[model samples]
Target: VESISVKKIETVEEFKDLKIQKSEKGRGISLTLPPDIAICEECLKDLRYKNKKKYYMYPFVACAVCGPRYTTVNALPYDRERSTMIEFPLCNEDKTSCVKEYKDFNNRRFHAQTFACAVCGPQYQLYDRSKNIIETNSIKEILEITARRINSGEIAAVKGMGGVHLICLAEDDKVLEELRNRKKERKYKPFAIMTPKLAILENLVIFSEKERELLTSFRRPIVILGKKKGSNDGILSNQVAPGLSSIGVMLPYAGIHYLLFDFIGQKSLIYTSGNVSNLPMGIRNEMIFEQLKGLADFFLLHNRTIFQRCDDSVLRVHNDKVKLIRRSRGYVPEYLPLPFEVEISGALATGPELNVTGAVLRRNRVFPTQHIGHIKSLETFNFLKNALFNIKNLLQIEDKEIEFIACDLHPSFYTTTYAKELAEKYGINYFPIQHHFAHVLGLM
Candidate 1:
């Protein structure tokens, strides 16, 4: 591979002077990040070997193919310094003294990015609904307590990959009722349950071979699987599926989630966004208290501040094909190369209504933000606005330098409205692309 180095530019003037060129004599491969993968076979073997120094019990063991992505990232270039991993500095002492060849090898995370261990990585904490500290520095003890409380029919707000999820034993009627009453979510919108693995899900859902494969895929989206005939009614109350024929299900996406499901003693558990219905998922403890005060009996939280809010992505298998209903988390931040590289520098794309996804265009690609959910509430709108700013800042683009702003033609859309306002405020040209046509153009 050919290499070139340029002085780092920290100012807009200096940034303008920098040039990125493609070699005239070569063809190269461009790889978008594999959407947050499940533990690969190599890493799984390393984890399963009991005698190995990095054994299966190591909760933080991961390879380049798997682990946290958009959730832990605070900015772009996707380096550790630009991510939440910056909170935990590298253990120089351990690095110098370690004898493991892999530890020092030029692998994916060998000075690649976002490397951490249980020793220096993020930690867990617990709190009551009243914001009183319950415990700290003990994830196992806290999870055990939370599981006990849940079994006793109490709701617990558990923080996970992207945002908080209110976890409850799926089979408990009283707990479901209490959760519904507390959150005032009386609608029949089915809750997504996290199964420990695909084997556990087969008992609850009658999945075709194709459906099973999609469910077990690396993306691990909340797949709307066909519920088994005469499945346990108490597992998910009728309220969970007032009119829908299927329920959403997903596998554990993080190591903590895997442990949580194991501790809960069930092969599966109810996992839904920890927020009032129609609002954004809770990202911080303070926000959780403000939004889910009476909704949760206790909080199993962590010290790591979520830099972004990504809801669980939803998908459905139809006619032997997987269709994405909501795209977030495991499938974001990676840029999509445009057919033609436009001159519009740092353009913001206010996505269409319903399953909204914002985008930031730079160079020859567009980076779509995680699913922002239906933009009907103030909370969702504020999230869109903040996400736009965050995307621009992370990409190191100034508002004044944004050459264009893109929005959907739907005038009724709040996102479109916001895009218009931003265009006016920034004195940039606004391009209103028809929603349907844009999708067609994208496919072409």
Candidate 2:
């Protein structure tokens, strides 16, 4: 199939029957599921493209090739009906012109399932801490007001593709201190900042060419880079990274983020996950309000549901190579091939107790989950279980098909105990591997 090529046809009607067939079980691998992609350059231009009136300033504007994937998908086959975008149906123009664009092979959005626009897509609205909505004239105005509030020292819970982010002015020490006080667990921990563009980042951070690539990459992970000599000359507050010499900085990845910067005067904004302590970041609207009740002074929420909670991935360039600090959002659900083929058809690895990301091995490929944070509390532990369940369902991996369940050697760890429980429930073999040994095996 890889070597096969299609012969040229004189007319479009000649290839009417040509189609992509679905992969059957044991025949081939399932369709590769991509992680949530950052907004593309064309879509960014469409935000202000006067001629593309439908998508003008649309925060949820997306096409077939880009936007939410793993985070929005609710089932296999990866169709719009099987994604969170199902509720937000296409508008008249989207159904006609946009649909035609997808049919056009030359168009970038050819056969794109996530096609959307302002008239018929998920919309954002600003709300107060008391759950009351703040009326606005337009979507652009809403973001402008939100930015003004954030700049005026108000914390905002901004809903992203996967989860909500607690946003505040990056250069306000008093605001940063208040955010720390509210998010008790983040007292000493550093917060990541989001810059509006790349030119501003060049003057603030000392990063290599490779580091710059990571910062502006489509995955858009938060890259840790050293600060310039006078980087903190009123641009960034000392409290951003505390004692650390490096700071986590990322460029605006979404349309909302870009629109927010359009109204604000700050060079960067503190963009940290909106969650308490060891719990997972909030995804549902009600859950977010409850989770970040007092922490966020205002809420910049959206109607689109985040099927899965994926935190921003963190990475750093060391010795001209990239090292993943926290892998999520842009990097999960993709398979990693093992060096040697194993006879086992399927296997499960319940990850460690902290910064956990479970893995499922199917045939020769190992599929790791999005970052699941610390699995210490019941909430986080359940989140891990659900994450594993979701990936398993997507891959159509049955419990009986799993050859073994692997866990940390430490018996007291929740993952270890869960592995044992799953083994018993599924009547499968279970094994324990030292945490460091598992890491070494992965690297090899």
Candidate 3:
């Protein structure tokens, strides 16, 4: 017998499906961030069950409640029109079914914009370094091939919601060594690992209930969990965390990620940004092909165009609240209201070189763009410009705002240079505060 529990409470919101509406800057409804979600149980069921036509053997299958959002979204209101999914229209049969389910208020897929099935969803393929199609149009076959290659200690550049990730069997030293050598990764920095389930995570790390919730939270940030006593022997490679007492772990967030864990039958894979050090991670197929051709043995390429390249969000629980270490992908371009209204209006701050996030103050509220990566390369500088432009539009701050641009006073820092350029373009004043002074004032 199937029954549903219903609760009604008096509120200002009469919600249907996840209705994302385009709101003006500083006044738009900040919905639950698209980042704080993981694979739901029903989708999991669809993956492992016998329903071959619906979700079985499909990698990109997603319902209304899950799958790619911030990465695929090109504009606000978060509709398919504003996303990279505009290219792949649903087939006629799938479109009919989608419309029926969309109009049905009780269905889980009601108005699910990212909804797709085996018959009409995005497809996956496996390719060699030369772009030779190793496997085509078969997620199961791709999984099988990826599993074999990973088990044999080869690196796979697997695509996901936001961007491509470099994955290898976590326990393989030879593979880790190869990855380190190829990427020129430092010896001490640990690579994050993706496990299949919480049970395996429990075995590997000493965690609290909050940490457990965080581990399994929809945001699915990489939680830095302390190592359980005697847990690292043979189960993990020493290279994963050279001298660290904690391990960064996450579970599968997408269907393809879950399928990979199922087929590999391994608990952990060394998951890292699929880019060279000091550069942005790759998102487009051509970008990956060009940037990671020599390093990756097999490429799990997909046709989906990632509208923006967002690295997986990274953070750790501390003192009961999660502290952000690297906020991208899952947590970019979110607006926050000041506890009390600020006296200032229309101010902009270009943050420091490392852990870069720019902020604009509009109508006494602060809206920070998601991490723009290190402001070093020419490409990154352009990204910073785009971020500033996008956030300005989101916050509805006109370019003519007479306020000044604030940035670090570091003589040779690229951010400072960018600030000067912005000042010149906008005919605004440039405020260059000392980096150390900013740090001290920030703490105060």
| Candidate achieving the largest lDDT | 2
Candidate 2 residue lDDT tens string, 35-104? 8889998888888787888888888777765798999988777777888888976654544466666567
lDDT of each: 0.71, 0.85, 0.76
Alpha-carbon RMSD of each model: 7.7, 2.7, 4.7
Off by over 4 Å in 3: 1-36, 94-96, 343-345
Tell me how candidate 3 scores on lDDT.
0.76
Sorted by lDDT (best first), the order is 2, 3, 1
Candidate 1 local distance difference test against the native: 0.71
Model 2: colliding residue pairs: 64-112
Model 3, span 178-203: residue lDDT tens: 88888875556899999988898777
Off by over 4 Å in 2: 1-27, 93-106
Give the residue spans of candidate 1 off by over 4 A.
Answer: 1-35, 39-63, 92-103, 106-109, 233-239, 335-346, 352-354, 362-366, 392-401, 410-413, 433-444
Question: Which 10 successive residues of model 1 have the least lDDT summed?
Answer: 23-32
Residue-wise lDDT of candidate 1 within 261-356, one digit each (tens)? 657775467788888767888898788888877788888777776878878789887888768778787776556788886766678888877778
Give the better candidate number (1 or 2) by lDDT.
Answer: 2
The TM-score that candidate 3 achieves is: 0.89
